[model samples]
Each structure stands twice: as C-alpha cells, then as structure tokens.
Target: MALLEVHDLVVEFPTRRGVLTAVDEISLHIDEGEVLGVVGESGAGKSMTGNAIIGLLEPPGRIARGEILLDGRRIDNLPYDQMRTIRGKEIGAIFQDPLTSLNPLYTVGEQLVETIQTHTDMTPTQARARALELLIEVGIPAPERRVDQYPHQFSGGMRQRVVIALALCVNPRLIVADEPTTALDVSIQAQIIALLKRLCSEHGTAVMLVTHDMGVIAETADRVAVMYAGRIAEVGPVKQVVKRARHPYTHGLMGSIPVIGHDADRLTQIEGAMPRLTDIPTGCAFNPRCPQATDRCLRDRPEPMPTEDGQVACWLFEKEAAHV
Candidate 1:
C-alpha cells in the first residue's frame, strides 16, 4: 500500500469577501522510500498541501473536503493530541528555513533529546547519546561539541543538516519537506538533496517534497506532481514528466529548466503569471497562461485523465501525445 495517500483534498480559507479555495481537489500518493515532488510557482498550494498533511495549516485555513490517510488509516480526522503524538514519531517535517524550525533558546542537543524522549522511553543519558549519533549521522562535524551549541552557531547548510537530524529523530516513516533547500546556495542545495535521497534509500522513508524549484525536484523526486493554481496539472514519474510532459503547464515548467547539453541561448519562459485566488480562471487554472489552451480548456475544467506514465488534467493530451 502507499505510505501516504491524499484523496480529493481541498484546502480553503474563509475570507471577508467569500471563501477562497487554495487547494482544489488535489489527489496523490507516495510509496515507502519514494520521494514525491509537488512542484509549482508560489501560491500553487504545494506548501499548503504539505502543511495540511503535517497539521500545521495556519488558522482560518482548513481542509474543507476530502481525506488524508497514512498507512491505510484516516489521519485528517484524528484528534489534535493523537495527531501530535504521531507527528514526530511517525511523520517528520523539514521546512525551508531551519532558523524558524529550530529553537534558538535551547541547545540543539536539548531539542533532539527532548524529541527522542517524547517518542521513546529512553533515559536522558540514552537520549543524549542518541542525539549525538543523529548529529553525526546527518554529517555535522564535531557532533560532540556542536550538539551543545544553539541553532545560531551552525551555518545554513549545517543547520539544515541539524533540522534533518531532528526530523529523523525517531526514524519517522515519512517526511513532508517543504522547500528544504531554498534558503541555501546551489552547492548547499545539492548537498541537502543528496542527504535526503540517501536517507530515503537507507531508511525507507517516504518524502513529500514541496518546492518551486524544478531543479531540486529533478534531482530528488522519484515522481513529480505539477500543480497550477491549487490544482494538479500533471503527475508522473520524474523522468517522464521532465522529458515528455503532457500538460502545457508541465511542459512549460520542464522547458524553463536549464539543460546541460542544450544550446538554447534563452530558457523557456511562461508568458503569464499564476492567477490570484480571487480571480482563478473558470476552466483550467492554467488556461490563461497556456499557449496551447483551446476553447474547451477555457470552458470546461478537465479532471485527471490517464497518461502513459501517470495522469494529466488537460484536453490537449492527445495533441501532446502526437507531438511526442
């Protein structure tokens, strides 16, 4: 069975003007040890999906419909206290900024030991040893000394490694990593990506990696889900989606990425911006920006239809296939 499942999930916000749907009927899954990348521009609801899964959605924004399941059991309806127990123990989260995720007041060792103790019956000594081992596991040098230091003492990359260690304190079955590498430079980003991939392979931990950077997705994710204006435009294996995207939105996204051997002087650029929540297009949310959009695309929203690799929500999949 899939490690995590999200079925027809909808996240909405109650506004003074009216209710705004931030995530519209999104559905996807991730298997054990698989990294499912949710990629899109800002406001595409990728991070919102992760937050919903992790039960961290800001107040006033809520799951209006559908369900989230983990290990074949429904988790969306789980009581707050019960879900709290499950979070660090069963599902971990790594965010974009390590600074916000880590507490500055406490030593890194204190935080890790607390988490370990919370989920296990280990003694303080045991927990501290475990914490040190975790720091070393995450590639923190001088874990002996660094463990006692506050979050501020570490570099951006090293602090992110600490966050990774904290997330894996109990060896959670899955992790919802939301833009985990955006705060770092290209080299640091690659290092974190490698670390995540290595962890998944070693520990069989599934990942829901949400990001706007296609480059990260290409490197880290096994499957790719392309979202536009809160809806999934396409989802498939990383290789297929990256090389033979079926939906125009996915195609545009793939085209925008720089290729190693390609001689193109300019990267492909999508013509328009993502639509605002207040003014999403009537049919496909991407119709306004999609160059191949047709009358049907502008008039009727398409649900996910089967593609060779996975599924795509587009009326032009036929033409796309022909082009392919």
Candidate 2:
C-alpha cells in the first residue's frame, strides 16, 4: 500500500492583491521506502505542498480543496490538537531551515527526549539514550557529548543531522523533507541525501523531498513530480521524467542541468519569470513560457491526462499517439 497520498490538493492565500493560489490541484503518492521528488523554480509551491501535508501551512494559507491521506487515513483539515498527535509521530517533517526549526533555549538531547517521551511511553532516561543513538545514527560526532549541545553550537551540517534525528524519533511512516540540505555545502548535501536514502531503505519510510535542484532529484528520487506556477505539469518514474520528459516544462528543466558528459558553454535556461500567484495565466499556467503552446492552449486549460509512462497536464500530449 502507498504510505502517503495527496489528491487534488489546493492551497490558497487571501492577500490584498487577490486570492493567490500557491498549490493548485496537485496530487501524488509515495510507496513504502520510496522517495518522491517535487522539483520546480521558486514559488512553484513545492514547499507549500509539504507544509499542507504536515498541517503546517502558515496563516492566510488554507487548504481550499482536496485530501491528504497517510496510510489511507484522511489528515487534511484535521483539528490542530488532533494533527499534533500525527505530526512528528506519524508524519515527520525536516524543514528547509534547521536553525529556525530547532529550539535555541533547549539542548538537542532535551528536545529529542521530550519529543520521544511525548509521543511514546519511554521514560526520561530511556528517551535520552534513544536520542543519543539517533544522533550517532544520523552521523553526528561524539553523540554522547554532542547530544547536550545547543542548536547554536552545532555547525550547519551537524544541525541538519540533529533535525533528522528528531524527525526519526517517533519512527514515522512518512517523512516530508523540504529542502533539508539547502543550508549545507555541496559535499554535506550528498551526505545528508545518502543518510536519508539509507534510513528509508532500512525502515520502510516513505519520503516527499521538495527541492529546486533537478540533479538532486535525479540522484535520490524514485519518482519525480514537476511543478510549475503552482500546478504539477508532469509526474512519472525518475528515469522516465528525466530522460523522456513529456511535458515542455520538464524538458526545459532537464536541459538546464549540466551533466558531466554533456558539454555546453552556457546552461540552457527557461525563459520568462514566474507569474505572480495572484495573476496566473487564464488557460495553462505554463502556456506563456511553453515553446509548444498553441492558440488552443491559451483558449482552454488542458486537464491532467494519463500517458503510457505516467501523467501530464498539457494539451501537446493529448493525441492518443503522442505519448506512445
């Protein structure tokens, strides 16, 4: 069974400008031990999608439509008190900013112990020991000594590891890591990715990884979902989406990446900037920038349609033979 399922989820914010849709009819699933990558440019709603799933979407932003199911149980729109039991216990979140997520006033050990104890029946000493073990498991040095350190004392990478450790404290079936490596260096980025992959494989943990880096998605994701202007343009297995991308937006993203073997003087780039959330185009959101866009694309929105490989929400892939 799929560990996590998000169906037709829409997140919108009411601003002075207008009702800005940050995530529009987005849907996907993650199987046990599977890593699903959500990639797009800034403001494409990748992080917002993560926030919605974990019941952490900030004020002014509300889930206007659709459902979020974890292990076949509905979680979207649940009361805050009810959702608290699920968050960190059933579905953990490793946010983009580790520093901001950690409590500066508490030691790493205290936070972890509190988390574990609050969710489980473990005694204080037992929780502390488990916290130490988790720290070491996530690659922290001298787990015994480091567990007592404050968030400010740890380096960027170490802090990220601590965050990971806290996320795993409850043995959550699913983990939503929204750009968890964004604060670390390139070398440390790889390490964190590897650690996440290893943990998922070992524990049957499903992951929803939100990032703007296509390379990171290529290396870590079992499946890829490409979002543009708050909607998913394409979704499929990693190999299919990366090598045989059907959507023009997905193609543009792959073209922009620099491969070790493929040489180019300058990286290919997608033209035009992201339209304001309050001012999304009339038909297809990506139509203004899509090279293959036609008059029909501007006149009418294309519904998400299934293809042989996966799914795409573009009219260019409408013909029966186009996807074959």
Candidate 3:
C-alpha cells in the first residue's frame, strides 16, 4: 500500500464574498522511501496541500470535501488533539523558512529532545543523544557542541539542517516539506536537497516535497505532480514529466526552466497568470492560460485520465483516449 494517500481533496475558505476553493479535487500517493515532488507557480496550492495533510490549515480554510489517509487510516477527520500528536509522530513537517519553524528562544537540543520524547519512550538522556546523532546525520558539524546552540547561532543552511533534524527526530513514516530550500542560498539549496535525499533514503521515509523550482524536483524526487491553479495538470515519473510533459501547463513549466548551454532571447513562458481563488474560471482552471485549450476545455473540466506512463487532466487527452 502507498504510505501516504490523498484522495479527491478540496480545500476551501469561507470568505465574506463567497466560498473560495483553493484546492480542487486532487489525488496522489507516495510510497515508502520515495519523494513525490509537488511543483507549480506560487499560489498554486502546493503548500496548502502540504498544510492540509499535516493538519495545519489556518481557521476559515478547511478541507471541504475528500479525505487524507496515512497508512490506510483516515487522518483528515481526527480531532485536533489526536492530529497534533500525529503531526510530529506519524508525519513530520519542514517549512521554507527554518527560522520560522525553529524556536529562537530554545536551544536546538531542547526542541529535538522534546519532539523525540513526545513520540518515543526515550529518557531525556537518550533523547539528547539521539538529537546529537540526528544533527550529525544531517551534516551539522560538531553536533556534540552545536546541539546546545540557539537557532540564531547557526548559518541559514545549518539552521535548515537543524529543522530537518527536528522533523526526523520522531522517525516519522512520511514528511511534508514545503519549499524547504527556498530560503537558502542557491549553493546551499543543493546541499540541503542532498541531505534530505540521503537521510530519507537511509531511514526509509517518504516525502511530499512542495516547491516551485523544477530543478530541485528533478534532482530529488522519484515522481512528479504538476499543479496549476489549484488542480493537478499532470503527474508521472520525474524523468517522463521533466522530459516529455503531456499537458500544456506542464510543458510550459518545463520549458520555462533555463537550460545551462542553451542560448535564447527570452525564456519560454505561459501567457496568463494563475487565476485568483475568488475568480477561478469555469471548467478547467488552466484553460485561460492553456495554449491548446479547446471549447470543451473552457466549458467542461476534465478528470485525470491515463497517458503514456502517468495521468493528465486535459480534454485533449480525453479525446485521444476515446479514439483508442
């Protein structure tokens, strides 16, 4: 069974004007020790999906429909207290800004020990030793001494490493990492990504990595899900989606990536901006920006249909499937 399953999830917000759907019916899964990259433009609901899975959606924003299951057990309906316990124990979370995720007031050791103790039956001494080991595992130098330092003491990259350590302290089965490298230097981003890949592989931890950087996804993920305007445009193995995208939106996203040796006057770009949640158009949310959009695309939303090796939600694919 898939380690993590998100089925037909619809995240909505109750606004004074009307209800706004931030995430439409989207589904995906991740297996143990695999990285599933969720990539899209900003405001594409990548982070929102991660937050929903980790039970961290702010007030007014809620899962209006569908379900989230971890290890074949429904967690979307679990009470706040139960879900709180599950957060650090069953599922870990790493956010874009390490500074925001880590408490500046507490020593790194204190935080890691607390998280470890909460989920495991380890004594304080054992938890502290584990915390130090985790810091070393994540490549923090001299973890024995660094463990007692505050968040402010570490460099940006080192602080992120600490956040990653805290996330893994409880030995969670899955992790929801939302833009975990966005706040770091370009050089540091690669190191952090490598660290996550190595540690998760060693521990057999599944990852839901949410980001806007296609390069990061290409490097770290086994599979990729391309989201656009709150819906999944395409999903498949990382190699296929990166090299042979089917949906126009996914194609545009891949094209927008700057190739190292290629010379161009300007990078390829999609014509229109993502729709605002309050003003999402009828039918396929991507129709307004899709170059291959048809009348059917503007009038009727398409469900995910099988493609060469993955799935794409597009009327064009549906018609092609019909002929087959």
Q: What are the models' TM-scores?
A: 0.97, 0.97, 0.97
Q: What is the C-alpha lDDT of each candidate?
A: 0.91, 0.90, 0.91
* Model 1 spans > 4 angstroms off: 318-324
**Model 1 C-alpha lDDT versus the unseen true structure:** 0.91
Q: Which ten residues in a row have the lowest lDDT in candidate 1?
A: 315-324
TM-score of 3: 0.97
**lDDT for position 12 in model 1:** 99
The CA root-mean-square deviation of candidate 2, after full C-alpha superposition on the true structure, stands at 1.4
Candidate 1 TM-score versus the reference: 0.97
Q: Write the per-residue lDDT of candidate 1 for residues 150-223, one digit (tens) a residue.
A: 99988899999999999999999999999999989888899999998898779999999999998888888899
Return model 3's CA RMSD, one decimal: 1.2
Tens-digit lDDT track for model 3 on 1-324?
998899999999999999988898989998988999999999998999999999999989999999999989999999999999999888999999986788889999999999998888999999999998899889988988998899999999999999999898888999999999999999999999999998899999999999999999999999999998889989999999999888889889988999999998899998979999888889888988888888988899889887767788888788665654
